[model samples]
Target: MPTTLPVGDVTSNGRTWRQSYAEDFTKPAALGTVASVYPGMGLYDGFQDTSGLGTYAPAKVLSVADGNLDFDFHSEDGRPLVAAVMPDGYAPHTTARVSIRYKTTVTDGYKFVGMLWPSSDEWNDGEIDWPESLTLGASPRPASAIPGTYANRHVKYDRSVQVHAKTDTTEYHVATTEWDTGIVRFYWDGELVSCTTEAVPTKPMRVTLQGETWTDHGAVPTDASGTVSVDWISIWN
Candidate 1:
């Protein structure tokens, strides 16, 4: 089944997250079974990868080889995760509900974080900073293991809840972002996890995936053995 990557009418300083991605890059270029590059092995051509990105870096692929799409995130500078673009020209002020059966992990002595961006470039581009990210599964406030923040002025959506990733274990879960007229709501597996309904962006935007190794305010790593994956990604009205 061909997945439809979704985008929205949101922008940031005329430079949404899509500034790095290009057009016709979201749909799966390679389908069915594929191989993946591994560390210590370094781009093995015969390791039986799930799927390969048409090009590496700056772009990641969602392979169904494992009954899910794997966005092989690496420890690269600048481009942490894949920030691809979707179709533009969303009806002005139209509400868009973006959902995906996606999950992430930060297992190998690092921090794990994901993102949802929106933009208006026909080149299928965009990236919006989260006003904030709320933590559900196994994190707490005042001292979060899986911390969520922003680079620009955007803040983390969900801060603290009860969602915690077991050290060295892969967690398969679902996350969603409800974006519409000036407000965005985030949910986890059909549950209302968190929501931001104020000070929404007045422009269009695109979808983005970002994960990295971050410190917990000079504290112990909640999830150190960093590695996260998403089974699938989809969007709807």
Candidate 2:
């Protein structure tokens, strides 16, 4: 049930964007959280495995590159990339619009997969798994396709990931999503790429980024220290 509420620019409840939504990453808290980290200079936090939620797993740190404090995660200790949703809480019957900017460096199948996983689990904060709305997608056959059971399925949220291949040093680009009930829409560089309404997730969620090994692309995240980096991330409720 997509609500008729109005949404705003930056951050909003439906019609208005919240000021905090467009916040710039700064010192200290800028790094977000690291599981086992070491803060230095512009990077305030370090990978502190024992530190818990606020910290990401796999002794990683937020480093500055290309005039931005981007996060580089490519290690066994590095936890699954995830973001936190403020206590403000998202509204019901409204759409959750999220946008993110990042760059990847890959070489093979290490599928550069980014998602909105529940920070609690990815960061080892709690036992609850992050609800997959746009990440999971819907589970019904599309009307446009021939009406019949087929091994090939059509999901409401058919999301595709981007890769920044190891050492490619190219800005894979930013993307946005609109989660409305059973539907999940995707946009890259402000252009709509997909619109799905399949296995829709209904719950509070967070942002996530990942680059795991994959054979489909015949690439894998090199076993290096820094393989992927993130420039900026935000969500418009």
Residue lDDT tens for model 1, 93-140: 233444444445533323333333333432222223321122222331
Instruction: Write the residue-wise lDDT of candidate 2 on 125-145 in tens digits.
Output: 111111111111111111111
C-alpha lDDT of all candidate models, in order: 0.35, 0.36
Which 10-residue span in candidate 2 carries the lowest summed lDDT? 138-147
Q: Residue 229 CA error for candidate 2 (Å)?
A: 2.6
Worst ten in a row by lDDT for model 1: 37-46
